[model samples]
Target: MLAPVTDHPDTAPLVDAVRQLRGAVAASSLPLPVEQVSAERTNRVELLNQLDDYVLPRLTSIDAPLLCVVGGSTGAGKSTLVNSLVGDVVSRSGVLRPTTRASVLIHNPDDTRWFADQRVLPGLARLTGAPTQQDDPGQLRLVASRNIPPGLALLDAPDIDSVVEANRDLARQLLAAADLWLFVTTATRYADAVPWGLLQQATERGTSVAVVLNRVPVDAMEEVRADLAGMLMQQGLGQSPVFAVLESRLSEQGLLPAAEVERMRSWLSSLAADSRARSIVIRRTLDGALDSLTGRASALAGAVTAQEMAAQALAQAAHEPYVRARGEIEEGISDGSLLRGEVLARWQEFVGTGEWFRQLDEGVSRVRDKIASVLRGRGRAAPVEDLGEALHTGVAALIASHGESAAMGAARNWRSLPGGSELLADDRSLAQVSPQFDERVQRLVREWQGDVLEMVRSEAGGRRTTARLLAFGINGIGVMLMLVVFSATGGMLAGAEIGVAGGSAIVAQRVLEAVFGDQAVRSLAAKARELLLRRVDEVLADERARYDQALGRVELDPGAAEQLDRAISQLKAVR
Candidate 1:
């Protein structure tokens, strides 16, 4: 065990920084680039577990004894090598398919306190009695031995390529928690894919590694050692020292001869006896782990930003269609499209087209006589109810068509994104027309017609309004306002093909202009048009809000990237 690290002013903040980064990464959610995000999240979680089980605890208690993990593939003689190094059978060694199921950590009795608590490899439950293959495989069996030096502990980990996948994963976790890896392999299996793959990872992490090439025939020792040395150098691990233990017959006690592992034993003894050497090894591995975490944390932060951007894109996709729909509705109101077809026919029927022109030619006073006579029933006109119903149907149909179109457009946009594709694949109803759409349209049209009546009644200003207003009740004036809303022109004859009934619409426009003036007529149209457009926008907004609610379900912290960046900066500064 290493001596506990002396307290420094920067230590507390550095620990907090690491903890904060771990929490941020744990809380991050990604809905896009589904496969890639899943891989990233898994890797980050593994790194975080490594920090908690090894790096942070070790860094805080730097004076604790060093832990050297004995790790290798199946049948690599790892258990035998560990037992030989300690000169006792502390770890199980056999020809079984997987000799070690649970890990065995051997420490000097004097250094028991270091491994006694839930500080190192805290995820693993501590075990005291000898572990059987049937015992829960998740525990770590601690064995105290005076033969092991005071400043070091040797952990015999499971085979990296055990037939059981859980053993392989546990082996990796144990290696990640080690201060150094004492990797053992037979001369015959040194070039096997599994152990070398692990060696490559150790190199990338800058973790200190020492290789022991065991069970080598004496004649082939020099050649195999040189070739293994070359492979290690090519893999960027030339500095990792390799020791050879020649193939030999086991003694009656089932242990290698003392001479066979003498060099490896002496090296570990020197490392443990010399505190400075132990400290150097710990510092090298610790620094490497911290540096690796800094880079990984920043990458995780970038992933968070990507998630945020994708969510925003989905929201914009649902919002943009409504914006276009609102513009179209406003354009239709201003450009006289609403006055086409049925509206024009209804207005023409409301007054006799030929009689209006004849009365107009007789002059303004005769026109007033014509209007009063028509109002008093000299002319048979369309009922106000018919015009009002037609206006309501036209406006409601416009809203319904545009509302359905917006829903489809938003669904198409969502399908174009990876995250959205998954969400919509199972629930396509989100893209369909809303079930309550017709009812909403009915309600909105009723509200708009009511608004138009209120506008006419208010614009009358209660002056000289009793007679003409009584001649045509509130519904009559409200229907007239709806017609004027459909056309910006005062019903003037711009062209024959133009939708409005130029003759009769102008007569209605003239009557209103006379009673309410040209400005008041314009104001009524403007107010009614504004109210209709406002209602349409509200309907669109409600539809768009469904997508917004989906985005809200994903938890993405806006400040996660900056928090990671700041933590990395502070970590580097302290180091």
Candidate 2:
């Protein structure tokens, strides 16, 4: 026989470890919308209830009174059976569908200290008398009866198949908390799927159990008893004693005949009086509960892992599109594509197109003097501000188009992922770029244009008085620098547009070289290009942050699964 838990060397450590394990299990959450998530959540709650209601309390108070929870289908005569066992009317019995709304624990008056406190079934509030009108189903009514044996307590649980879902749930919870189950069923309900399902659970958990076949017809007693015995044997519950109570009328106090309950009552009395027998029952149930923890904990860990994987997949889906958008934007700036449309037209006007282009091949001095005479004779101002506005419009459109595309791509990818639709529904703004995107893009382009002008002025430091700089002016040179940056990779351009754009770039580069020298012009272009790309990167990152914020609401803890595994290992080692 197993030794009493109170005398075991590892009892204290074992309890501590189980307590830690309970904390770990409670912390594991399945917030993501993965498959089978509901079932796993229910399993998690049941495991926690078992640990809190039974395992920890039992381990700590190994010598506490044996708690036998009487449970079965609706109208199973559970309350009547408890009253008969105690030989008093401590528990109310009736014809109502669920006579026991709240659980009633009847203990020997001498053993009141055990049931009066929150040592076991701590989830429930304790009431000191018979259930009254004001009692809620969540409270546990404690009845101190002198007729009950000293070392035993009988808890009349709600019907397992009660029409009320809360009652059924409470019944299952109470059964999981039992050291022994005294399942009462009438001849009609003996074959019920509900009670038998619970009986199977009891067998699996190694809980000590006994069956009382209540209200058996006198003529069918022998046959019904034998059939039930065979069924119990087939279910691996053969060792559990079965008692048959012949159909009999109730007494004035609505109690079963004394002769009919004497046998089962004697059996309970004997088990309670014998310390060794009580210890065996407690050890059997407690060990089974501890052993079952590994598999349940492992299953919970698997669910946590699933949540983490799903979250990662969703994040990756959102991330890839933004990466593509950034790359495409970088390519757009380098390939001379932005030099078309209004920007090209503005550039032509600023440089005095047609005859002015034909004279560009002349030596730098002759070309500079010709430009000054042509501009001074025309008596018309250069369109420098107009060119700047055109550049602003082209660059902003490029960035905004790619930003919109990235948003659409991410939303489409998320639609195909598990649980992604729900998140999208919760925050519909993720499907589109942020409302401030256009405003931010416009601001970014304007700032970039300002920086380009500043770079031009700084590069012209000592050369501002040169004839070439005086001819086109600072604004004229700044816009030319902007055009050169757009066509820096002109070799990559294609078709007829390439010649137009490439020729435009060469003219701007020659003019800039006249003022700042060849090396200074190239350095200025590189610096301006670097600055523009960096600003674009920041704008795109802010747009991506919208999706990230949505994801943050549902992401599970990355370390939760590992914590649960470690807790399980610690508990197993102590066991």
Candidate 3:
């Protein structure tokens, strides 16, 4: 049994047939989720458009006749069954055994050309020799006759699970072409598992089916028949008809009895007895197919959703490191570490020898004192050293913690995702980050260094003495401006030198800043923004990588599906 699915992606537009209904299905648009709402509305339209490609083609290509395929294990009397039903030996009926090699599809002679070259279904064929009804008895030569009636073509397939692999492959191919299947088996070999597995193929694709019991002993007939029927019922194939064939001795003319042939003919008539039976078979086949397909559909959907969750989790996890790193960087910029170079540069320019001599001991002793304090404070804290190794440890920890835990984690997780995994959809795919992506992320974090250093450098641009010369800060600039205010008043104090400093002496001091009382506002604002940028960036990057990797992994390997689920769990916890 199989499912009859009429609507699916890549078919006709779902709402296209609305002209008959005097309206349409609004097939052009579907509402997208808020998260997916982009500047363009294309994906929404694509959801509907998929029907044109995935579904419509399968529907329109249904012009081929309904194939009634007869298949079974070797010596199930399938050939004899096919022969008896057709009222002719269209296929060889044999005792010398295992005769059929190529699958023979018997159809109307005119229809042979419709499918002769088909690789998938092979061909409806015609016999070359017309010698006799008994000619080439065991060769199982083809016999394409037009007597099968319209809308029906009969296929005789090779045995599944055959000793020859090619024959088994042929069986599989024939199964694909069968719109209806007649599974013939004997009472002795009824409970075999291979045929049931093969039947799953048809059941999953809406193929109509009938079961035939070709040989049954008189005493065990009822029990065997019931047992087989019970199995079918368990598999939800109860509606499929069961037909019986009794083996008989050949007549003197080596021909089957007329009554046995008539019984086989009667079965064919029942197949086409009325439209109701045809519809029943069709519906049952379609339903069975749907049942088999449901499991696969569920699995695929779970994989997709799980991938999404994993990406989100990895992103948020990455944020923690960046947040910590950003704080460290901002604090350094604010207090002094980032500005050390500029401070030294300006100190050489303005203070030169005068302030250098004064502050040299103070600064170096401050550094020495810090080291001594640490060495002395070991009972309370820990000893400190001025060596490069000592300096490197704290600095390195600040850099490594955020980059590795947040950024690298995100990259790895995303790289594991489908779109971001290996064999990416594009080079840009972020699914779990690879070694290459890790290198790229390091570059992004390093760029932040320039910003941090620049902020410190800008504040330290002029020497402290030069700043004192202008007297432009909160503590001293007012006094310098006041001196100019008094001296520049001129002539009122005759003999007083009123000469101001060079070109910059006339520059207006921060009278407004004094009034507003927020002298460090600009520097503070820049520092805050930079800090936030680092933190947010770290979080976003980690998640994006994890998401992409998980997605990519899903696409690349089925084994990654479980990993995808784990990633999804990580994603849900991210926020």
Candidate 4:
């Protein structure tokens, strides 16, 4: 980084900010609906490599040695050129197509420490001499050379257009990590699309680049050089100097004549000897890399946002149906629908239905005494138990049907979402309610009946009231509360076809009013309705938890967008 010079801006903070941006993007996931998968992957890899390889390393030591990566299309004589330029066989040159498997970096012994550690190009493992270990493409063979100048290093990378995908990727990564790209291309492959594509990238990145036209025949050198120069100018690279290495007889080392590479070698020597030139190259590439981060990081941030939103949409889809089902279950209870069949029949048989209203009008105290006396018979509890069991079964079935419907609705909605469909395909059981759901509903109903009985016992206020409660028994009054709970919309007295069940609710209301005053009856009904609804809510929550677990597995990246924005803001401040 820039040491705090007298008036110059500090660069350490800027480097740290970019590193933060790189870390955020590195941890983010690129889920579906990304603009382009391959392009996004390439951009992410480039940003990370730029941070690890060039910007951080170079900024840490601004005066470190220069690295020039020699890259070209397959069979372009890059290794041979590297050996010729250094005047030694430090790098192996051969006739095999796509010859360079692992990269080799040659540096002067005086500058070995600068390249020995991972300060520069940290992704690559540094080694000495010919490789004795397994051929790992991620490693670089560092050969300390006396022929090369003190302030420079030459890295012979793989072919840019290799048949192997890994080799091509490594070449691009190496080039991005270089302070200078000394591109070598044969006269015939100069206009190839792949090499030109990379050159265009170099132009865009503002990296220092030079070209070597190797194996050009002497007769057409003028024509080919002119055309290559014109192409370079057309591609916004006219400022890049071009050198020609003419076809000539090889020496005993199978290398070109010494005179053929003299011009390029002399230019490299001059570049190494001039500290200002090396500094300019490093600064140009570093600034370009820094400038590109904002746009790249912003795009990655957008991808993170898309992934988060998609996950949210999927989760909402899984929940909306269950929410609707809970509402419908409550509605059914409030509308007197569950009291219709067996519950109504049994209550009427137990209460002597058709004359129940006539009996209620004979004065509250007298009606309470008469009902209590009738309910005290030893035979009364069996009919009460039957009615309670009928209500329990009805409520349990109601809950089970709604739970199944909610499960189906949630499954149907989830099937239309992006990642949801895949999850459902692998786990089709989610579309149906659990087999134990009905048993849970039964248990809940039984618990609710017990709650109603406790409520009745608590509402009885005095000795006479206690005597009446024991005579009628808690079972009779508890069933009365449940029947009132189901008739929340209005009892059968409001002119419904289910008036038989409605009469039972009305008789229960009158009896409770006789035992606990008019206000107490209304309060008891309100309390019973509240307890029943609360119990049903608990059941619905249990059912909805299944879908909740599914959505929980999505694992959306939290705070990734904010991290990116903060890093970008810091970078902008430094700029």
Highest lDDT model number:
2
Highest TM-score scorer:
2
lDDT of 2 by residue, 176-233 (tens): 9999999999988799998898898888777888899999998889889999999999
Scored by Cα lDDT, where does model 3 land?
A: 0.46
lDDT by candidate, in order shown: 0.78, 0.86, 0.46, 0.79
TM-score each candidate: 0.83, 0.91, 0.49, 0.84
lDDT of 1 by residue, 316-351 (tens): 888888788778777666556666667666655555
lDDT of 2 at 568: 85
lDDT of each residue in 1-575, candidate 3, tens digit only:
22133334342432232121111112121121223323123322221222232122223444444567788887787766776666666665566555566555666666554445432232323344332444321222344675665445677777876777667655665655555788999998778889887676555555677888877776877888899999988776788788776667655534556676576556665655455655455445434433433343234334334444544444444444455555654443233232123322322232122332333345543332342343334421111112112223333343445445545544454455432333233444332333554444445444433343344344434434342222223212222122122122232222312221211112212221222223543443445345535643564455445544443443223333444334323322321
1-575 per-residue lDDT for model 4 (tens digits): 32221123666776677677778877776554434645776877887787788877877777888899999998889999998988877777778776787799999999989988888778787777675436567888999988899889999999999988988989999998888999999889999999999999887776789999999999989999999999999999898989999988777887788898899988988888999887788787777766667888888777678767777777688778778887887777767777787887787666654665566666766666766666665367887898999888888887788888988988898778766776677667788887778887888888888888887877764435567566667788788778877775443234454565565677777777656777877887788778777887887777777766765665556788888888888878766
Q: Model 4 residue 35 lDDT? A: 40
What candidate 4 gets wrong by more than 4 Å, as runs, is 1-9, 19-38, 91-99, 159-168, 186-196, 213-231, 244-257, 352-378, 422-439, 461-468, 490-498, 535-557
lDDT of 2: 0.86
Relative to the true structure, candidate 4 has a C-alpha RMSD (angstroms) of 4.2
Ranking under TM-score, best-scoring first? 2, 4, 1, 3
Q: Candidate 1 has which clashing residue pairs, if any?
A: 1-64, 1-65, 2-63, 2-64, 2-65, 3-63, 3-64, 4-63
